[model samples]
Target: MRKNRLKLGLFIPPFHPLYENPTLCIERDLQITQFADEIGMSEIWFGEHHSGGYEIIMSPELMVAAAAERTKSIKLGTGVITLPYHNPLMTANRLCQLDHQTRGRLLFGGGPGLLTADAHMLGLDARESRDKLDEGISVISRLLAGEWVTEKTSWYDLNDAHCHLLPYNGPGSLPIGVASAFSPSGGTLAAKYDTAMLCLAATSPDGYDALAGNWKIACDTAEKYGRTMNPAVLRCATDMHIAETRDEAMDQARKGFEVTQRYFANQTAHVANEGMDVTLEDLIERGEAVVGTPDDAVAQIRRLEEKVPDFGTLLLLDKNWATFENKKRSLEMMMRYVLPEINGDNVSRQKSFDWQGEHAEEYFKTFQQAAQRAFEKHAAQTEADK
Candidate 1:
């Protein structure tokens, strides 16, 4: 068992098919957020996208603001705001305000834009996105810290600019994270900024293989800056659809997974041309997803722990691969069964039950003796009265 309990969260890239009603889709997302909050999910991160029709959320801040109103405890995050696309000063200001709006429950996450098309539309060279992200993070971090920044970049300029509204927790107190996939850049950036690492591709083959290596990179980079990487803030993101049985889970998730894979095939080279043909079995066998029972979800999380032992959070990638009812069921099952088992939440309960069983004979004997004594005393009193 881990010394620290692992936390569960949701990463909503929100892969809704083009066929679904967009309005209802967003509504369902909020409903999911509310349900997750009610069930005690630690956090939920919304994604930002510009051109991808499938990932429809344009501003994760708006989603966070809307969700903040609907939820009570679950911390909301921009799974990532693509830094290169936004002005750093404006981005920092919005985040600081959201930190207040969410009552300090906001988590800031930034990344290089995911879509080449989004970059192309902005007339940005996709190759330069990472460098721009690096620059944006520096500027945004400073602005959020209430520093008056006078910096100029090829894309944007900041002239003694600072956020009027600092974060609710005060300057340099906001929890920030950087999105990391197969590259070491995320780890390096996270180390440089002392932010959390959101391992967005944790369950994927390449990403899984890179997990330990990436953490090592982060530690090494942090060492260079005389800082230590905190494993408690490291979050691993993966796809999962759990039910009472593997077959049922597969049945629920199959069609939607196929649709999502087809969409991926069109958008990214990560999926092959025949990606749509990939089945739930393939996903499970390849270890890319968990489409099974709560036990299987627990096992998958343990597997990730074995790779990166102290990772803080398991962020379920909200692919909407299962129907809404089944999806909710999956999350409930995780909370009721998987989480307790993994975190040892039931250890004391189980021990108390066993202790009572072990002492049952002695307890029964004492109860019998006390009843006999009471009966004898009552008979003596009756005889004396007679």
Candidate 2:
């Protein structure tokens, strides 16, 4: 109902199959979260995958916990957890407990399993995925609203089982969300439950225009019930990377991003059995990509705002999966430079790369010598021979 403008979120891609060495990845994600908090970035969300290259793991709850532990002020979400795949009691309990744990710092996001492989992994028929989604969601919704839900179905049943756990967030609704990718069913379900909707997309405004149109269709279908459902919390993923120089940032981003994109495009290809061609320029023009220099990119984001008046959040795919160094650089650029400008929070002149890094290190070296002299004297005086 709170129609705040331009919320920022991040999508973490599965960088490795081994899932080894998440300490660095965790730190990097937290760093972005911390910075977003500092800069008043509105919200943050990660996603879920069972197997495949999306690497964050099969659990958005765990990743949400990780981010929650590191941040106090930002709204953390699952972007969406595939609801149909999990037991409703466990799933509802997790969302309730996490909401309690973070003092309601959680956003409950859900979706039917996107991947057929995901349904297969759980030994469920792919045909039943969406049906299970409805059933799973119904159980959670009832329990959260303090209904003594009898989970009576092929999937589940709970006689006299309900949440006395937490007070209802509102008279009629739980803090529920749904993820949809051009599926009319996803949108309609969100509306049916009065849950917020999180829509996922790869970059390419051309496709994005098409995609948002799909959401509108879902929204229109939801409108048949009327009487004013909430204003609708809708989100789109933006693949993001920002830096001092346009050319350098794009060059660094290209190889790493394309590799990550291929992983996703391939997953989508197999699941939907449909191939998609995603482009950088289309991403930029669509206003959902993580490319471009700070200046131009901010303008593009604003352009997206104009194009999609209902846009709620810009989810950034800021991960540079190739290396810690690249990932850290991407984070720094987004936080220190890109986020502020795009949020309209700062307008300082960013003549960053126009001046130089290599060309300017020498100048900083002279200042470093002066700083060292001043620091040594200050330390000697302050420590007093210790």
Candidate 3:
């Protein structure tokens, strides 16, 4: 029963079928962002991908910039910027500019690129990329803080490098989150920097088991680094879709589940490795992918909180594992139903409904009398007008 403000948001890689037009896929993702804003979703995070046709958005910052113009209140974030892919100085400046463009609604997520192919094409090895991630984050953080850094490092050297344009929200308000995908690299960075942690694979059993341990690591790192770690700002993400009924949701999800599964398995092994019997049903059963009714979604989230208490946000992994209509409907149901249930907003409404039902006859008679009076008043008004 650990209670906290459960903010809703989407972590969209903006997946699409290989045969589909890339422009259309990007447009559809933008449309979803606008829709999410209209429905009071607090944030929308876009992923950075280079090689994959399914995850076609190569620049999450660009996508966020476009989404910024379309959305007013919803915060736009880089699902991650893949720090290894860009120059740290340039990243710091670009993100600073984005913070102003977005009117201070930017959450800068730092991570090493997930796809090995993406790194290899850019002439980076795993060791080099991880080192870059570490250095890149450090450099970006310093630049964001308006520090003039001069250093000769492994990858790139900067001579008194500093960002000309600082963040619109001042120095510290724009959040910096680190993405942890079944690894401690992100958690360590988050701790050392005193930033937010995004547990990208928290839905998996291994991920879930490591949740508390990772936070402990973060806490220890924070203590060693003389920084404060706020566990409440940590976000746990999971694949989720909701409908009017569990069977209906599963039916709708079955249409595109395998397509999504294949993409994840092929692209980054985010779902399951090949030749594994991890079906859509298996994911749902394991609390990895929740394709069910709003009630079921609520129950799953409660269970997650039970396992890891006091965690702040539950990020619903946005994907097209159903029809466009079904996907939209699922998000709508999540906002209208699941959110209220988890936040306890539905308790008073349910209580009021029960109270009314207990005195139904009396309430019906009173309503009938009130309607008669209204009708008679309307007739009298008509006569007076005549």
Candidate 4:
């Protein structure tokens, strides 16, 4: 077999395990992330949320900075940062500062703010989200590019604006990833800007199929604009729980997904009429969440690979706010017992390390997603029997 070279990362969400003590939350998060760095993991990516339904960490930059200082190798990312919530100038400057602070170990993740709570907390309405995201990104992209630009609209205004943001190792370098649950618009932007696409995989291959459509449209859009698109830059996230036995795995996931379902249910109350059909737990049992022992999870993942061969990037971990110990145990199990088996890639580590490798972020989040990419590539290589 050819070398798989797949990457795996622990998805560190802000939501605490459902049973964690509030006082020890910060300490626990630090401990887990540091351990992930020490455990020879590729990256540690977290998302942004306001009003604190689960975890207290909301500022992706602040968290990335703190993670950068503590760990020498593991890549830190916004996992995602909602672009629409802040003044473009300030958000762009801050992200650029983080890039410099981490010496270029930063990923620019573009996502519109989700819940009404997050928008409300920012003193905005969700109805204006798409427009806000586009405007903010327009300004941020130029600001990072050494462009003296201006944007004047009824919504936001910038006059003769310029920003001094240092690019990583080179004069112009920073890998940006765009997060989209199901919007073709994000996929279009990803290709247009040469950024990667992130899809939440906590649901099903059905969700994978849905996101894949966006990726396709993105490429089509790029082609329409006389631009080239590379299918290799795909990214996705999976809600996965691994354990010693199938029953044990299901039990762990039951608790975690229950909490997640409730949290989102409460958050999506006013928006319930949006026709959100499936519960988070339903996404779990339907081969989407991958809740089971290693063998079972592997089978489910392989099926997904057969179906969507170009998918890459995935979030395999979730918040450990309430059940810190349980979550930690699960993470350890995943690292030791589950991950190596699925991708079965060669992993090298030191009690401490000198290099974290170049594609650390991709390697971490794109392991299973890579399977789809691989299956697609592999099948293409083999000639069909006439």
Candidate 5:
């Protein structure tokens, strides 16, 4: 099989236990981002959620800014900022400022708010959220590009509105990615706008299965719109937990696995509904979650790469699904072991073994001499005893 080389990232929804203090959760999240940077992770994505008690972060931009200030080199992104929840002008300006703050290390992800109750609380109809997202993205794109946006959408309006502080990366410097699950809308929008696709549900079997078709749709649509799409722009994310050994990984996952399921059940019915009836084995079999050692993680990633063929980044979904210590160890192992193996770092290690093989005869001669001396000494001792 061909080696699959890919960049690694974290999609920290920053999920915490409802019983745990939110402040502590947020602090740990910051520390994890720093850890990821230190370990050579290419990027870190923060999720924005409003209504979920566990997904307590109201703003990913703030989190990204906080993370960026604490780390260097690791690109920061919004797993998504629910476009429908904020006006385009505000969102654009904040992101542009973040781009500058992070020194052009910002990846902008925009999508419709996922929670129905969140939209409802904001006086937006559940049905209008997607439409609002589409419109908001369109407007935000213009504003970010230093264009004065003047338009009236049902959910929001912008008249002569423009962001004075454009992206530090330059005009159109913002790399916009649209979040999608099993739907084609994300691909369609990405193609039309020449943006990226954030396959948020890439871990799910249904999501994994849709990848090839989604890429096709995005490419064809991009060609039709006289634009070019890069396959590397596609980011596929999956849930994962790795330990020193497969048994340890599975046991640790089992410890807090049900709590995660319950969180999904109450806060994200769409995702929870699919797994509520299945066992952990079933979920792993379906490519919905990965809980094992580094070897298993490598195998699962290869499986995903084979399915998508050219997908770029593998984002590990961050949840409080294991003990905090185990979670840190898992990511460290990924960086130290799995990532290197996948990226062919082991080839360098193999060179030393090859050198040893080349000098095998010399090594064997030395070993034989040492053994003969030891045997002779033992014989002398035995003779003395006699």
Candidate 6:
């Protein structure tokens, strides 16, 4: 078992139904960040999406800036800024600024954008996204290192471009992460840039199967670069919703799951065509989601640990499967019960309790002997007074 406690966090691609108010949806997201910070969650990430009505945040940097003020300790991340859609120089500058704004609490997450619709809106070929992301990270990494970058590409050209401000902790001090779904591209890029690997689909059957293979890819790629992949920075994300009981959790998440899945099915071809008919049982049986009690959540995480063995964090992929209150309750339950169990946080306490139980007779005998001694001393004292 990895002795180091696995950190807990949230990756809020933030699925909201079309019927909800957008303003309130964003506010709730910020509130969740604040609540997570108060409850000592390690971090929270916001996503960038332009075309997806369900995953609406548009600018994760803007969310980070807003969340930075509202939060104190939890690290804020661009769950990913779609690298193919933006100028590397501009993105680097914004990242540097956010690093300072968050007082070094910003995690820069970059990815080839997820949605083809988003790429289409920018008049970009979706096929070129991965290459563009690779190029973008390279340029951004160089610029952030305080190097004068004079690079040219079909999409962008930098003429002696340098960030006005380096990362708050100095160049290369800012933590970087790349999103990996089921492909080796993310692992390859992570090793190339020495960034953390964010296994965004770790709980899905395919993603789970790829865990060891992806780590191997990262390690092999890093060997080429003479750099070692750090398992301590590897983060795995999964869908989870927990309550006091499995039935209660299932009830809370059932309707929301339908809404979100239907949206995914419409926007994402890879999503199950069953749409609204997809049941919570279907997700659980497939190991695609954990919509049950905290014990169920612990089991899901342990299952992941079995595959990867050593990962830095378990990030709950935030969903609106439950109401805001229920969602908050789920997070609370995770911190209060699920995390402690997985990390063995209460092992010593349990041992101490069992030891006391085992020695109950001996302890009672000692107490009785002390009481007898006190009574004898009092009787003698009374006689002396008389």
User: Evaluated with lDDT, which candidate comes out highest?
Assistant: 1
Work out candidate 4's RMSD over C-alphas.
15.0
Every candidate's lDDT: 0.92, 0.65, 0.84, 0.66, 0.85, 0.90
Q: Write the per-residue lDDT of candidate 3 for residues 1-386, one digit (tens) a residue.
A: 24566878899877788877888889989999999999998888999988876888889999999999999999999989988878789999899999999999998998888888888888888667666788888888988988999987877789989989999978756789988866777778888777888888887888987877887788889989888777677888988888888888888888587776667777545544543346888887777778888888888887777656677778888778887788889888888988887788878888899998999999899999999999999999999999
| Candidate 2 C-alpha lDDT tens digits along 1-386 | 12454566666543542345656666666666676666666677766777664565567788777777778788877767777677787787778777766667788787776677777878888787777777877778887776776657877767877765753354234467777665577677877777776656534534456555656665676788673333336666656666667676677677665666666677765324423466555555546565656676566566555545646666775455335555556655656665566554543334555556646878889889999999999988989966
Global lDDT of model 2 = 0.65
Q: TM-score of model 4 relative to the true fold?
A: 0.78
Query: Deviation in angstroms for 29 in model 4?
Result: 2.2
* Residue range with the least summed lDDT across 10 consecutive positions in model 2: 166-175
Q: Where is the poorest 10-residue window by lDDT in model 6?
A: 267-276
Clashing pairs in 2: 14-54, 14-55, 151-157, 151-158, 204-282, 204-283, 205-286, 239-290, 240-290, 241-290
Question: How far in Å is the alpha carbon of 353 misplaced in model 5?
Answer: 4.2
Candidate 6 per-residue lDDT, tens place, 282-336, comes to 8899999998888889889889888777688999999888998999999999999
Order of the predicted models by lDDT, top scorer first: 1, 6, 5, 3, 4, 2
**Candidate 3 displacement at residue 219 in angstroms:** 2.4
> What is the TM-score (0 to 1) of candidate 2?
0.75
**Better candidate by lDDT, 2 or 3:** 3
State the RMSD for candidate 5: 6.1
Candidate no. 3 TM-score:
0.88
Q: Candidate 4's residue-wise lDDT over 70-169, tens digit each?
A: 8878778886778876677777778778888888877777777766777887687788886666666667777777777777865668887776655665
- lDDT of candidate 1 at residue 361, scale 0 to 100: 100
Q: Relative to the unseen true structure, what is the C-alpha lDDT of residue 156 in candidate 1, on a scale of 0 to 100?
A: 94
Candidates 1 and 3 compared by lDDT, better number:
1
